[model samples]
Target: MELELKKLSPEDGRDVYDLLQALPADENGFMNPANGLSYDQYRDWLRFAAACLEQVGVVDGKVPETIFWLYEDGRPIGMGKVRHLMTEALLEKGGNIGYAILPSARGRGLGKKFLALLASESKQLHAGRLLLTIQNHNQPSIRVALANGGRIERVTADRHYIWIDP
Candidate 1:
């Protein structure tokens, strides 16, 4: 399948909205601010997300983030995020990259490709080694990280801190 990575933008349509809806809620730390939003509200959230990339209106304690969509054959099937700078809290948990494949798209080797795509995106942002905080129980992600040259750097009660060369 043809694969492409695209930056998040206001021009995204219902596909992105549907993808966000399919993803877990932000309370789960998935960066899905558009969950449960009305279509118009989701549109607004798109602009807000762009503003976040510019460090224009990020909330206090939140780092500026760049969002990208992983598309297969021209349709979005996964999303990823890269925080511009690092923070202690981030290193301890959130890390530099966060990604999720559409539930329907899981187990198809897309997660590995998506992580690789995010790593390249991070390099473009001039980030050094990449950090990925994976849930302890998520074996697929743990494997994905490792496949992308990630090494287990630390282990917390509920998370595995991994580092991958960019």
Candidate 2:
């Protein structure tokens, strides 16, 4: 199947919201509470995403983040995020890229493809290398990272830190 990565847009709110509905609340670290918002709220979140790319908005000292969605035949299948610049906190735990394929779409090697696409996108931003952190128990995600040229940099109690040259 053909796959493409598209930057998130306000118009994509409904599709993203629907995709979120099909996923468990806490399945993917990439998704936060705001992502589960209804269409209206999600549209606001999209605006927040755009503002993040433009470096706007703040909440309790946190900044907004850029988000992208994976599409197949025009339907949303997964989502990913690229922090414009990594903060110290991100470097320690968040990493540079975060992504999640819908539950129904798992086990098809799509995660690797998704990360590959995100890596290309990160390179465009002039980032020398991308950092990705996967939970220790998420073997599938670890495989995906490895398949995309990611090398383990370190491992913490709950996560694996990987670096991929973009």
Candidate 3:
């Protein structure tokens, strides 16, 4: 399948949020079981996504940064976010990167490709190490991380944090 990655725009928020909302509920209306974000949290997350995209324009005075919105067959399919470096939570569990593939696009290799794209961008940022965390039971995510050279650092009930050293 052909997928294109584009810089996310504020107008993309509605579409992104709508897509996230349409995700298959895990008996709790959340895309991931490990994510305890309530409906409102999801809403806020969409807004945050938009803000992140806006920030990318001037991200530390660097224009044309590396945040991307994945499109499959010309339709929005996912979103990928890359932090310049690792944060405390990221170092511990969240990781320096995070990605979400549309529920309908899960089985495809989009997530892996997205990770590779982020990793390449992180490298440009002089990042020698990248972190990615996923829920232990999230086999697909785990597989994606592993496929992208992620080394299992540790596993927790809420997540399995992996380290990706470029």
Per-residue C-alpha lDDT of model 1 across residues 1-166, encoded as one tens digit per residue = 9999999998999988888888877633656767789999988899988888888333688888899999999889998998877878888778889888988988999999999989988888876888888888888889999999999888889999899988
Model 3 Cα lDDT, one tens digit per residue, 77-135: 77666666554545665566767777777786888887887777677666578777777
TM-score per model over all chains:
0.93, 0.88, 0.67
Q: For model 2, how does the per-residue alpha-carbon lDDT over 1-166 read when each residue is reduced to its tens digit?
A: 7899888776675677887677555663655555456777777777776766766444555645667889977889987888656677878777788888888888988889899999898777665688887889988888999998899999999999999988
lDDT of 3 at 118: 73
Tell me the whole-model lDDT of each prediction, alpha carbons only: 0.86, 0.78, 0.65
Ranking of all candidate structures by their lDDT, best first: 1, 2, 3
Clashing pairs in 3: 90-95
Flag regions of model 1 displaced more than 4 Å: 26-28, 56-59
Model 1 has an lDDT value of 0.86
- Candidate achieving the largest lDDT: 1
Off by over 4 Å in 2: 56-64
The TM-score of predicted model 3 comes to: 0.67
